[model samples]
Target: MADKEATVYVVDLGASMGDCHNGRDESDLDFGMRYVWDKISTTVAASRKTWTLGFVGLNTDETNNTQDEEGLEGYHNISTLQEIGPMTMTELRELHPKVKPCEAYSGDALSAIVVAITMIEEFTKKLKFKRRIILVTNGESPIDDEDDSITDVAEKLNEHNIELVIIGVDFDDPEYGFKEEDKSRAKRQNEETLRKLVEACENGVFGTMQQAVEELSIPRIKPVRPFKAYDGPLTLGDPNKYESAISINVERYFKTKRATPPSATTVVVNPDRGYTQSQAFDDGDVEMGGTEFSNVKHMRKYKVNDPSAPGGKLDVPYEELAKGYLYGRTVVPFSDSDMAITKYETTKSFTIIGFIPFDSYSPFLNMGETGLIAAKKFDEKSEIGLSALIHALHELESYAVARYVQKDGAQVQILLLKPNPGIEDEYECLYDVPLPFAEDVRSYQFPPLDKVLTVSGNVLKEHRLLPNQDLKEAMSDFVDAMDLSGFDVDEDGNPVDYAPIDEVYNPVIHRLNQAIRTRAVHPDGEIGPPPEILLRFSKPPEKLIKKARPDIEALIDAAELKKVPEKAKGRFKEAVKPLSGLDIDAILGQKKRTVISPENAIPEFKQALATAEDDETVEKAVKQMGEIIRKLITNSFADVFYPRAAENLRVLREELIGLDLPLLYNKFLRALKKSLLSGELNGDRREMWFKYIIGGQLGLVTKEESEMSDVTEEDAKAFVKK
Candidate 1:
């Protein structure tokens, strides 16, 4: 349980809020208000504490027209629609109509803050609670230079220890049609003023409306410290045969207190000033100058329903009633002034009693039924105690020690025990305390408390632990080949020289080696290291065909009609003739056949072309091309782009060019374009496909390249129209 909290939502109801945002039917104000309402509603519902909510409108026209020395006094347009108190869905629903923007001018935000502070202070005066004000606005209000009113309001809020959370909605969102050029100097000044106001609060969080709403919606539970194991030891007893003791651990659980509702009190108030008083007295009651004073009582009035009346209502006061205890009880009501404070207290205790022989208690520990004889005192009282103990043990759901206990001078003994944490009640226990030797004594070694554990030197010295060394070397070579820099830099940006291999690298390398050994196999008609590991450490194969003959045949058969031209049919057949006699099923084992089709490849290519500028899209394209290249290379094609599909490849290449990619990427695209245009390849496409082999290898296009591209806003609009 937590303490009570109060939150006041000060929403800006300016004319600008009426403008739609991001093409949405709802205005910015509508979205902002809805987000605020939902957030507050959710917080109230989910909070463990009692939460009170209030709503206030800024830039509203609920002010009086008053004149001062100046022609007309500035209006304090702040409107307190709902005072800070316990809020209900029905009450909130009724406020929708009242939250409309002002018809004349923007309301005074500074005035709204001052009013909200007053309301919250009045409401939470006697309550011990956390207070906060959530300001939802677009930061588009006119600044008031009247003695720094905004600063004064902020100072007052901070002095009261009230946290401020500003949800600033962007006015320039396209849906609002507020272009960058249309922003006025006043709007910028307002933004600066809002920022200053936010910074003035000690505990403040400022963010976009969406971000603020999301953060508020998320359930925020206060974190509790992790439970540490108890290091103290416990003693076990037999009470008759012998006492056996061992060091043990335990954790404590305490019950929580229930919340109580606030007490209500009745008070008399003055009608004129609306202030509560001890009694409702009039001027006539005080007759200081009179010779004598008369003591007269006053009767209160009430409203009663009457069907005969025009509005079915009637006014009356207390009158003669049936003389009974009920009427007298109603006249003089009673209430309790004293309140009870709840506290967490422990109600039960548990401990291990003793250990039993493994052979005798094994059945009971394993199957919940024991052959050991029950002690005489294992009666109703002990049964009840054992039931509670068993329930606690079951809830812990972990290992426990079983022991024999003698009671009431009985010959037979009972078994008592303790369990570990997180163990289930329904699970069978199959563990036992073993008597290791004929001497009936045993010893076990435990780690020294002060000792620091580290990896053994012998394990690091083993060569098999160096499998990841090759991977590291390959990575280094790849970086060198790519002319990469800044990977090993100091704080001052200078390169640091150190041995590539070090003690720190041993653990990572050993772990990687363990993973490889466990998951990979050796080559030679036997399972080999995974292709990824092999490819990282060694050069790629010229022909990426499976070891099995039937796989090669199957791949060739699938691609023959679609990929290979009639003139190249003989060459394709000759390339796969060597694999015609092997068993593909045995080599593949339980794995399903994976056929790479252009149907899948072309869609990925189109998607890549459309979003190549995106890192994620480029990465996906690289991976897809890797698979396509492997299949094409193994199927006797020197390149993926062949004469038979030149026209299709040419169209795709032009589309890639139209995207206006970076120079490095264009180079790779040019290679593909040239291959398509030439209708042949000198060697396997795999040899020159390194640039596109890794995803996210391309950088953003240069500014010059972006400007030189022919695509324009009008072009995109025309494309959309079509």
Candidate 2:
């Protein structure tokens, strides 16, 4: 379990706390205490081993009456109910009745801070615990004396490394019902003082009632250390040879290094010194000018600060360091002499001494006792190694030869075997025999080709019937019958055939001549000559055709027979239709007028209502008026329509009362209820609808308002029934 933290909640029980806010029935002090206690209980339940809570109420009845007490001389109106201790469900339940606003005066903010600090100091004496003081108030603290200020308390809290949180319940909240004139100047001053006090502490938070409560409900989860597992294979014996070896699992830790060289270059100059002359016994001539000066370049090694050694640094080599891998927590340094060869620092977490073969490897990969695979608790390395081996074998489509080590200290091993591509499955392994070449191998016998050959009599008959003369004659006749002369080619060289007119005329003319001959000998007696025959010759057979066909002549003169009669003459003339019996004068008058604004809509709505003959018509007009008003409100004319709606509702109510039509009144109320219940209005629109339409205009009681009013349950039942 982690170390426990001590939290002291400093609740304000001043006179102002007796006032209710936030649409609740209880006073602010009552609601705030309940909310705070609920959060504390939740936190304690979630982190039973990590949290201890305490309670302190300011401006209690006992503290308000007593001006001074030992060790608390200057701090008045402060009551310490519980010292910081492990919280329990019973203790939390007992706090509800104890925290109340029964005091006559406002709480002293500085005094409350002093009491909380003193309590926390004593509570954290034996055991060092994180301390926090939560002060919940309405920012209406009593004025401090000249000698002491809230800053003094904040300094003391900071010195002790305690956190201070101020939960401010704004008295000027609209729900509190405080007017502009009712806001005291001292309230602003008190708020500023509280803000300064919070700023004074290193870890202090000032928030509203809601923010404070919400923050406490969130669960604080401790972070876990991160780690990674090994993914490749590790074996004890040579991997390529089919030698018995033990499979093992291992984990790896990565180490990285950067090569940083010296920032500046240095050069060393060696000047040749002139030789000195010897004394009188000088055996050889002294050389004055010897060798020239040579410049040698040198580089300083870059050093990094060593955190383990105070005021110490270590030099780094110019070459890049090799990456190191560790199996466990142990770190092994890379060998500089053998830098070309890579090596892993591994710890034997598990050893596989046996092997079990199954038809499928999937069961071994599963996680339970029924699974075929098993491993040691510290076998992460071996697990990864075995998985890699199995994956490789599966990829290569091969199997392994399991061989257990027979030696006393030897580990087991499995050698993977792949089939030889050159060997056939049917052939046995042979050492001395060599196979013959493909061209030198023995061959099989073949049958004679002449003995297998034969011919059918039908083949000879089909040869004699080739290219029949009858088909050739028929195709020739078809080609001659088709008239290709009329066919022509277009600009694009594609054939365009105009249909032969002679083919169309011959068929129709033959049918017409047959019909004329047949009709000349009609059953009723010969009808002279057929008209088609006379008309085809271009002869004036109109007189003969007209005499022969009276029906045709009537059809030709039918247009003259169907002329409409002249408009009705004399006194029986029709009057103009009255335009579907509608009052054109009224419609025209309305069309001539323009609706310039929302205010103009109001008069028109009023006229509609006045002219309505029945309740149904009046209801329709009211609905239309409401639509107009709603549009005006959406268009930023709410200020105009709001008051207008109120006045109109008042007038309508009075008119309803004068008429004494209870049914109409009930219907109107039902419509208003439906409008409020429907989800048409959202957010601010809903609030506006409730404030103006339901409460102000219709005077309907909402569920919340009803609970606070004199209306009884029976009255509600009767209203709903109606």
Give the distance in Å from residue 373's predicted Cα in candidate 1 to where it truly belongs: 33
lDDT of 1 by residue, 1-722 (tens): 55678888888888877877556687878778757755554553343337787888777766531221224445466667777776543444456568776653566666666667777788788567788988888767775744477678778888777888876776333433433445568766776676678787787766666555444322233333333221122224432355553223222211122222223233332234432222213643212111123345566766679999768888764553222335755754322321112222232222364433323433323322222111113245443433444455556543345332222222222223433222554422222221222243345887444333446623242243233444445545444433323334688989654223221122333333423322221112232233232233244233322223444444445434244334212101222222356655457683321332554666556545443445455545544554464344345455344332333333343444454433334444445534523535444443333323212222122344364344455543343233
* lDDT per residue (tens digit) for residues 1-722 in model 2: 46568888888888888897656687777657645755574454444656887888887776631235564465666777776777654454456567777654655777777777877787687577888989888766575743357667778988888999887775332443433335567877776677778787899987667554444333222333323222223354545574676554433221112222213223233334343332111322222112122334457776779876556876777675544658598767676767645433333232232333435333223221110122223667665555565555445655443332323344332222222222354311101111223453567887432233225523232232342344445445444434344344678877665333322223234334334323322223343333342234344235434443544333435322344445433212332235366866577775322232455655665455444456666666556555554454444333554566555555554444433333344455556545545634321344445666556645533333323234455654565545
The regions of model 1 sitting more than 4 angstroms off are: 47-49, 64-75, 145-147, 171-182, 213-251, 254-347, 353-722
Report the number of the highest-lDDT candidate: 2
TM-score of candidate 1 against the unseen true structure: 0.35
Clashing pairs in 2: 245-412, 245-413, 248-382, 249-381, 249-382, 250-381
- lDDT of predicted model 2: 0.52
State in Å the error of residue 455, model 1. 50
